[model samples]
Target: MSNEFNDEFVKEIPDHVRQRLDQTYEKIRFQSKKKKKHNIWMRMTAAACCLLIVGIASTSEPVKAAISGIFKFNDSGIEQAVNAGFAEETDQSATNENVRITLDSYFSDYNKIGFSFQLLFEDPTLLSGKVEWISLDVRLKNGDGEYIVEFIPDTKPLYGKSDYSVGVHVMNPIIEQKTGIAQFDTVFDSTEGNFPALSNAVIEVESINVQYANGEFKKIDGEWNLPLNKAAKPFEVVEYVARESDKIKIVKANGNPTSLSLTISIDGEPTETPFAIMKVVDEQGIEYEAGSTNMTVKKGYTLISTTFPISSFVHAEKLQLIVGNEEVELTKTND
Candidate 1:
């Protein structure tokens, strides 16, 4: 079971722990805003930092009514979408080495997929101190047992810093001081057209490796393969007019309950500005956060598809898809 804390629970946490959490949160928000919109490192760092906050905060509970719940995303838009039942809920549990891991929630929109996991320790003292890092050897496959996603951590140093690696798609989990339960989220890389049908998908976690603050390491190896009951709910393709620039044309811009996908056709020569790095803004000039992004070169024009966390556009009368300096007007036909 997980400990539930209220908004006032921060005061109960140790001063040092609270300070560290605040600092880490600030760092994550700053990096997320300053980096490229499609950078995967930002997502990984944000997830780890969020887990750190939750793990440490769960240690001290000031006697509140416990409620069942999972973690939340830092993005307000995505959080709202999740709250509105945009994600698939599940409670599949698997135990190994006295530790229980539960797959609580999952969501996918073809372009991107994300899921949350909760770990409960039988011996709470195992997570009594700051946990430096936790790595899970995770792989995903379709119903036919064909591998779809594999996390291969980079081995070489990234610009003389080995603590973090670049080009790694796995969202590594981080742990801090906690009592028993720790929850975290993971978003896979942009699948583009490579993602197979989501029906009956199986997620296998071969092992989980943990590194503690005191230079201690722990590895829990087991065969944990969980099956999904169905495929992700398909995104509703909102009506829109194709808009084009001298450099590119917006052929497809669709919206789902939690995300927006934009596909653009690059004209003759590639523009100096990369579409994947551009900001995704709505009609109100509000910029949404980017998820997984991929670019492909076709026979004539290059195709770039990037997903943004914009909640939904079903109710909106007028919307805009702004990528860099280019803006595409999207008018909802049924409106």
Candidate 2:
């Protein structure tokens, strides 16, 4: 039985079937080897694709190393974006290590109300610097699609401690109402001051130019006129008198008996002093001897006289007398 089993196993297979089996085995082996090679190639391709993606991302929008940044307004978010475009353009234009630019109100809106900007930049080098000059162009448009006014800075080159002329341009050639020019100084880091020193730097508004759509620009020429002095009239002393005599004598008789001879001095306002009658009062309640005849002041008496305007005395409530450093109150009498 073992010999018979051996003989059956050793029997030759049909040619067609043998050939088909051989072909099927070879195809299976080729497919397995091809799959292994394909897997390796796929992994390499994936790794290459990842490296290319990383390289593109790194070079696309490279980060900038800015040395100094200048912000003009309190809210400069929008202005910063607009300036970014300028900066990009400038970056392509020049090759400098340091750059500075002054920004003015004309860059933003037509209202002539915008913050000024000053920028300082440093390149990644020891040499080669750049400076960019920028300013706003303000123009007002009317309903007729015509510019009512075109405002621009003057042609004077901006320099340190130099005045720049600013004004408006008209469509017409006529020059009329042009504003004056104001000069101001620009502060830099080398000014030997603190951070706030730059802030205190003044921007003088020199001349203002106004233009009409009809092409007419007028140069309004005039110094800044100050308002007239309308200050309220200061307090004025209408009447002042110093009594030095110990024995009070009434030389003049008015309707009231309290009249006495007084030396008067006045200060302030321009007016004629009205005739005033004076009165004499003693420590004891005693009236001085005076007849119906109006007594004239005794001669050889030291009587100093001065006059003041009526407006000065209008607000005086009471008249006080200082005799020997003693203040004496006097009653007001109708004269």
Candidate 3:
């Protein structure tokens, strides 16, 4: 959590790293903002911010520190992130009394969304030890303002058991333990009832809460919203009939460099395991881990989704979704 690499040390960027940063930064900067603000203020929190800029050119101290945060700051491994998906951060900030939370940068595909945030507790003493538990009240809406996923802890009692007992923690327990200034990475799943790709999603952190083993707790109650362009490729979605029932269908393979996943749809409750990976085979007989299913049940057809840490894959040449020994053709992979 301590940043040994200062901004001064990062002043001299290597030619290769600089080139990669520029390429990624420009593409994201020029992305059509008719949707979301992929605009400015992607400034890094510390010298580690340089990681988002340098693109891992070497084994230097700065590169290692930043890359190590890939998992802490994101749900997927850094090696799995697509180089093209790197976006210039459009930070969204909100302050409540002595607490300030900044939504650093975020990205989304069909079902998975990831974001990084920096929290500054003006009253550092309020936090005494390691953050033993954490959770958020998230509300997501589309362009027409339809509620896509609304889990408000006040009305419902879900997402309330995020315990941080060492191994079961969310963020890097080591880095997140400290008070005052700290950063965290998180992801949200949006595939429900085999719904089509979202046009645009506006998600708001209605509230954030954290707890410690030492009976200490802290929270910031208010809206910390960010708009996301899913970059959804509707035509690229793939379909697979379920092993359990024909009515139950596994839909779409949405992916970027960092994460990949598919959605399952069925009437009533779904019987398929949501966390199991759907093995994929390519044209050259190459194999890749597509996703481990994560799901949510709804009124009509229950839907499921999951993501993998496959960083170097964006789209597949020819792919197949394998559940057990059964194989299904995926005509197009999401980009």
Which digits, one per residue and each the tens of the lDDT, describe model 2 over residues 231-328? Answer: 21122122223333443322221111111223322222213212233223333332221111111122333222211111112223344443323444
TM-score-better candidate, 2 vs 3? 3
Quantify all predictions' global Cα lDDT against the true fold.
0.53, 0.22, 0.44
lDDT per residue for candidate 1 within 1-335, as digits (tens), equals: 11123354222334554344343233322121232233322333332323333334443441121213433434444555678776787767788878777777787654446777766677878777766545565666667756555542332111221111111122223242444655555655341323445878888777676656665667677877767775666656555555466776877766655556666777543544465445555555666655545455566667666666666633455666666667667766663
**Candidate 1 steric clashes:** 0
Residue pairs with backbone atoms closer than 3 Å in model 1 (clashes): none
TM-score of each: 0.69, 0.15, 0.53
Better by TM-score, candidate 2 or 1: 1
- The alpha-carbon RMSD values of the candidates against the true structure, listed in the order shown, are 8.9, 45.8, 14.7
RMSD (CA, angstroms), candidate 2: 45.8
Q: Model 1: which ten-residue window has the lowest total lDDT?
A: 156-165
Error of 3 at 3 (Å): 29
lDDT: the better of candidates 1 and 3: 1
Best by TM-score: 1
